[model samples]
Target: MAADTAKVDPMHQFAIEPLFGSDWTFAGHNIAFTNSALWMLIAGICLWIFMIGGMKREVVPGRWQMAVETMTGFIDDLLEANMGKEGRKYVPYVFTLFMFILFANLLGLIPLPLAMAGVHAFTFTSHFTVTGVLAIMTFAIVLTVGFWKHGLHFFSLFVPHGTPPLMIPLIFVIELISFLFRPFSLGLRLFVAMMSGHVLLEVLSSFVIDAANAGPGYGVLIGGPSFILMIAICALELLVAGIQAYVFALLTSLYINDAEHLH
Candidate 1:
């Protein structure tokens, strides 16, 4: 039993296995409906239902309606606080980002009997590739909006307004590097946080399972504390899921502000 626990692979949760028929290769590219892709699609659908289905005009809002309104207002306030009036135009993009991430993060916590059924549960955002793509999309938007609005003047963003002429070149190089690293940093932050938390949970769960297999006495002695800690960690992860989503959206809004105002 102890040996089995030792062999438990916490990182296995992040594997992107094919969801349909055996993995296929087309034109030297592997195209398969992976668990990651499925989870992403599920998250998108859930978000659509939450936002679109809740759009019923009522004089007295129900719980679901209130939840939808509160979420909308929260994102609206987030954009307005960061980008002022100009941020209004980006509500759709930012809101979509927030909903996708929030739902993905939350969905990952749902424990299904996948192993018993020869399947596996996965968290799309736990993979760096997914988060990296999201970060790149946000970065691309920033660049497009910046260049479109400022033309060649977008390059001027790398130079501080009050920099000494002699130091301008050095500052520009530093700023350029900083700008280029945004996607990596943003993606890594989310991936590491989600991955690490899930890994810890898996490890604790393994301990609980091992204790139960050993005996009722051992289960009471060991599994009890492990189970309590698991619950606490789960609650914390739920809070983190929401916070990381908000942070990602808030940072995007700030980046948009930088592009628009060049400050």
Candidate 2:
């Protein structure tokens, strides 16, 4: 009966509950702080500490400074590859974006078991609402830069140079649609990728627990394999977290490049 009573729902961990209270309102909308928000704040703080550590200005750099400089250099190189020297000016925002997403993704995999202690370890990137907002912000910047720099000529982005008259309309419509759909794809990609890995880990965890509770035979047969796979997947999730962050920042730079160069 005890074994039968134990239950596991893979999606349970993603639930967002108000940490302070749900009464927070602004402009007639609930704006209560949540587990998701708490984690985001934590990530922001961690990023700040990371950046501040790099400001030591020591002639002989330590590992802390090196790590920070490495990340900054990597992003700078990425932007340069995508946008040339003009990309240097955009480093602050892009670096922050990359580190924030990287922190959010890695923090979610800390294995702290906060839920068991009546605390939640939230992954904001797993939520479409959060990811979508980031994507929209990047997209908004691209649009703003495009229009600001080129004025109405920004529309030329939808029609490549030397586009034949007959194909211009079709190409323009296709390009416009593909451009507009980018935010949705960007958001959905990160949200689904992050959420799916966590879900699989949760499901395998249930198998490991319930199978072990069943009997030694089941434990060896099912629990063992599930536990091993879970560990492997957990490690893979770490790599996936970094990859997702890199991809998000990379795409942002690419989109910004398009706006800058209109190519």
Encode model 2's per-residue lDDT on 169-193: one tens digit a residue: 8999999999999999999999999
Which ranges in model 1 have alpha carbons more than 4 Å from their true place? 21-28, 113-115, 118-120, 214-218
At residue 107, candidate 2 shows an lDDT of 90
Name the best candidate (by lDDT).
2
Cα-based TM-score, every candidate? 0.92, 0.97
Best candidate per TM-score, number?
Answer: 2
Model 2 lDDT-worst window of ten: 113-122
Error of 1 at 59 (Å): 4.1
Residue-level error in angstroms, candidate 1, position 179: 1.1
At residue 140, candidate 2 shows an lDDT of 98
Tens-digit lDDT string for candidate 1 (78-172): 99988889989999899999889999999998877776574655789998989999999999999999999999899999997999999999999
